[model samples]
Target: MERKTLITSTRNLAQLFATLEVKEASPQYSLDLAWPNSHNISVSIKRDDLLHPIISGNKWRKLKYSLAQILGSRTLHIVSFGGGFSNHLHALGFCCHRLNIRFTAIVRGDYSANPSPMLHDLQMWQTDIQYVNKITYQQRESPAYLTLLHQQYPNALIIPEGGSNKLALQGVAEIISELDQHYDYIIAPVASGGTLAGLIKATAHSATHILGIAALKGQGYLEEHVQALLPQTYQHWGICHDYHFGGYAKRSNELVDFCNDFYHQTRIEIEPIYSGKLMYAVKDLINRNYFNKGSRLLILHTGGLQGSRAIGQRASIL
Candidate 1:
């Protein structure tokens, strides 16, 4: 897909967002995993990672409508929060750069001295970086702090950490329409629960069941987070918090090995932070006979390959 030229005109910006072009279709490929249980289950992956080069996977979906709102309004600056290796900030910075808008990233922890590959990419995209202590970072969502931020940067649109908002949910809901065939299960990685919330909302009345593998430790609060985004009660979805490996952004030798093996087998790159853990959970569940025989499963490959750079020795463990 051709990149849209940057424009300052409201009409042109509206048109650009209205007709934003992403890769028409991301190819889905069948995956073969050695399951411990004797059951007839088929697995396939929706390669949302191929949606775009930078704004890939669920990040693009989350940002689609958020950017539209920013451009449609008089907001000239976009402010958001993330960690050192945040794909959310990386994608948001790239989008802001392409759209000719200013992006300010409030980074968690004092990572200004040592930058990761994701942070470097954000810098390359001309994102204004601000380092904050953990204490201040925790106040990111406080009403007083948000009010202060608005006062500091007038006309700036503050996107929640991970871009998990109502607009983001709307964009993620569109992912369901991209699937050509129906499956019994739809599984995705859950961080802040925006993508899973969107999927649950889209499949609330369908026969398909939505499973969210939490990517963070103690993510039971994700149920409430997802419920807040959805308009009505959704009972077709459940979350599994056992696959985080260690915790958010934490990796292990086993995870690295799995990621390497998965890439070698499927020719698809997966970062340990999200997609790797998701595949790990899917395989573990399959082994434990979690799915009925003859069940078809669809896994969402929400991209974060850029984060693989920070894996250090673990990336070479395989």
Candidate 2:
């Protein structure tokens, strides 16, 4: 009887993934920068931002397998931790709503006073938005706190803050198969380290070097998170800590100006939080002649454009 039920759940989840209408592969476009490339290096962007308006880019990739596993299990309720304007929560809320699964977003800080655009969407999606203090939220990954949550919601599947798990790595690694050709270096913005770790896993045996441009201030902290998710040791990947600007979601005038100019030059929309910092780092590296003369670089445009709506006028390029 249990086996029969499991088979049915697996079929249902597969059908749901099929009906999700997500783009199987995002297109890559050559970047035409206004500045000249003195090193004769070429840069192309894998437009994963075009994956979906909401569940786009790394968000979709990171959550795809997790959602599949959740649906195959007896658990129908999902509990996750994130900030009020988190793209992970926003995408997960939409997916859960579409699948008719119960979702509870354990958001950090009291956004009830001034809810973000993401929180508003969560409400519309019928998600249980639970705002907790920073101190309590800090215990999100603690075994004791997770045990407490397991006790509270026995039928719930608890996803970590950014949905960075082994399942997420599997989905993220799929990006490598979708690529038409290989490049010397593959670069992406690092947040929870899942995306970078995924790229690392995909190119683990390959000669391609993976570079993660940090969007936040964490140096050793982010590396530790990436290492935890990786199955084995890999020296082909490294994280750059210079382009964080001012930590996660924090923006600067210089960064904003660069994003705006980039839009005018290439017409590719980027937010200051993630993609902006990524492009900025790439350009800075290029100007500093970081890449060899014949090196080709592939930039992963991990989409979180929806979260930009929360910042409103801050993302003037959007």
Candidate 3:
């Protein structure tokens, strides 16, 4: 009976993933910047955002292998941590609901009075939402708390915050295989470092350089996280730390204006959190003549459009 249930659960999980329709390769297009550039630098964006409406961009890549492993192991429950406007939790909750897998989102703060759009979705999906204060949330990786969580939900597969793990790197690395052409620099927003790490791992052997635009202020620690995920040392990748604006999820008026202007000019929507900062950094780099003359750049648009809705913007623009 247990084996039969496991087979059924795996089959359902497989079918749910199939329904996501994550393409083998997402669309890529050039960005015609309105500003002048003396250097012959060209920029293009890989629209990973179009991977799905909900399970979009790098979130889908990061979770792909992890969910497969969990389901293959017959684990029917998932526990993970995230902030109020987390794309990770939002995507996870939707997938778990589709697979009939129990999900618990250990949210980092009390939002009972005013829940974010993501929190509302979690409620709609019937996710077990547990609000914890910042201090307790900091102990998420502590062995003591993990042990306690194991005792509480023995059957649940506990994923780390941002789903940055070995399996996630594997999924992110696959992005390289789908690309039809080579780029001088392949760029993506760096938060927990998994997505950038995956790019680094993927192109470690190639001449293509992986550039991560840091969306937050953790310069030193973010490098450490990426290094830790790497199997060995590789110097083909680097990060740009100056474009974070204020900090994670904290955007300045300048950043917001840039995003709006970018959307208006290119008809490509970007939020201030990740893609906006990345595009901003590219613009700055080009203006400052950072890239070599005639160099080509490819930016990965890791989608978190739902976050735009959280800030009361049109979800389409995020």
TM-score of 1: 0.91
**Each prediction's RMSD to truth:** 4.3, 2.4, 3.4
Ranking 2 against 3 by TM-score, winner: 2
Ranking by TM-score: 2, 3, 1
Over 1-318, each residue of candidate 2 has an lDDT whose tens digit, in order, gives 999876876786576667677887899977767565734888889999888888979998999878887777778999999998899999999999998899999999998989999999999999999999999999999999999999998979999988898888988998899988879999999989899999999998888999999999999999999999998899999999999987888888888888888888888888888999999999989888888898989999999888778665345664
Local error of candidate 3 at residue 290 (angstroms): 0.5
Estimate, for each residue in 1-318, the C-alpha lDDT of model 3 and write its tens digit: 999866866674566568666565689887777766824877888999988889989998999877877766778999999999999999999988887889999999999999998999999999999999999999998999999999999979999899998889988988899887889999999999899989998898799999999999998989998999999999998888999987998788788888888898888788988999998898888888888998989999999878768684443454
Candidate 2 stretches with Cα past 4 Å from truth are 1-14, 313-315
Q: State residue 121's C-alpha deviation in candidate 3, in Å.
A: 0.3
In candidate 3, the residue pairs with backbone N, CA or C atoms under 3 Å apart (3 or more residues apart, or in different chains) clash, namely: none
Q: TM-score for every candidate vs. truth?
A: 0.91, 0.94, 0.93
Q: Which is the better candidate, 1 or 2, if ranked by lDDT?
A: 2
lDDT of each: 0.84, 0.88, 0.88
**How displaced is residue 192 in candidate 3, in Å?**
0.6
Identify the superior model by lDDT, candidate 1 or candidate 3. Answer: 3
Candidate with maximal lDDT? 2
